[model samples]
Target: MSETDRPRPRRRRPFRKAVGLAVLLAVIGYFLVQRASNSGPAYCTASATGAGTAGAGTVQTYEMTHEQAANAATIAAVGISKGLPDRAVTIALATAMQESALRNLDHGDRDSLGLFQQRPSQGWGTPQQIMDPVYSAGIFYDRLAEIKGYTRLPLTVAAQKVQLSGFPQAYAKHEPDAAVLTAAFGENGIPASLACSGPAPAAGDPEKVRAELARAFGKEAREALGAGRAGAAAGRSKPAGTVSEAEVGLRLKEGGGPAEARRGRAMAHWAVARSKELGIVRVSYDGSSWVAGRDGGAWRGKGGEGGRKGGAGDPHDAAPGEVRIFVARATAH
Candidate 1:
């Protein structure tokens, strides 16, 4: 073909540029979706023995939101602090699950309220007191304790005597899920065994964390939390150049003993469950650590522990039974 008659080469540069731009936008959109997914609702699960039942055996998981897990944890913790056995914690958890699905609701069937749906007219307590998970749990445990050989009684029988729910058999179904949670939030549960896919909080309050800890776990928790604050004050791990004023170092104990170690695990899991509400950014106990927004706050080894220069303190730097909790402090305006 003559040179003049030859068709000019189609301009591919603009086409290529447009394609590249579209690809870039798609990539950005993918990341945005991923970020949104990561920050979505908080979820926790445990494998029940017979598939979604607590114990040991099957791979089935019982799932619940951060709120439910927190309530259930509190129920179990109260029972434990009162020197009740694991069985007691399990019964309480299952009963709470059946009555309120582990929620601290302000209302229920026929003036019922709170975790166990205790009614005001029934002499359980006033509506205000019933709404308090701690009080409700304590009262429930008290009633459960009164049942002669309650632990030896059938799960439904035990819970029914205390709850007196119309659907006493309902407690049977939650037993598996309760068992899973009991195994996790209970002292017998593994360290960092439970996880919640909560996004990093906008800000955190160290004081609130301490108050909640004291409220849930009582005096020992308060003392251990104080020790952690002291450590942060004395220049523990952080992101360099910045102070750890917003960090809390809860030394579960000076060293590991069986009770202390188990307690540490329970405390660590509690922080994880309450991470969403407490503005917890990270939780570290023993050689493992969990950072909010990372793999849904899944526990990871100390590989990320190094090179932490101190802005918030390295969570993995916990000594012995220590648990480090970090909050995203509000930046000075």
Candidate 2:
């Protein structure tokens, strides 16, 4: 009975375990690739700040430290003028202001760049393309425009279409910022000021700016951006003087390296974010401030050092300002 009942103990098939493990690994790899291809998740605050006013059935505002409004407005204007609808502009502004405060940060979700924090590896564009505000914004709009119904798409949906962000819903909060920019820069809407409040443009070493761009792109964070765009490894090199507008634009286009662009964009947005309190009627970069009757705008030069009227101290200090969003005055319709 023992001999018959003990008929060959069933042999354990270790290969089955091996096959199971292999399948598990393959699934994990698939998801990893998917996340990597999607440009990763957005770093955002869960709560809302009253900085921006609600409109068009939306009740959210891009959460920014006191300094992101100007940058958000500028980014929104550029996006809208580039043919992106108000919704797209709002998503882009919120993403930038929240991720890098509308700065063309050379950093982000693993080698993401520019105002929208697009990653070159994720097919947003090259690091250079992602860094250039126009190019970057254009790329974002290109993606956004492709959405089936982007204009009517919710802020998060439109942004997710363009960004492929892991946190797909994060873009909802920036609607207010986009709306504000729309009202200010729309066809005949009131103009809200935009400016920079960081270290005044000086004849300092330009290389430093380059480095900052890299850092903002998440280089400082040393994020693991697998197979980044070819030229993305190189850090931005500042020339021996104050960076020119062309240079700034170029750096933004180049992307990758240190995130100097992010820092610059941050300062610019911070100024815009605080414009009302600072009484900043207009803001300009390596280029010009706004002029009502001039085709060519004006760049604030060394002579414009004290350009910030309300005694804005070091921009990095995160000082509070007097102005708040006057929604009624700044609305478009």
| Candidate 2 lDDT by residue in tens digits, 235-302 | 23444442322112122223532223333333333333433333332333333232111211122332
TM-score per candidate, chains pooled: 0.78, 0.41
Q: How badly does each model clash, as a count of residue pairs?
A: 16, 39
Give residue 270's lDDT in candidate 2 (0 to 100): 33
- All candidates' lDDT scores? 0.73, 0.42
Top TM-score hit:
1
The superposed Cα distance between candidate 1 and the true structure at residue 299, in angstroms, equals 0.9
CA lDDT for candidate 1: 0.73
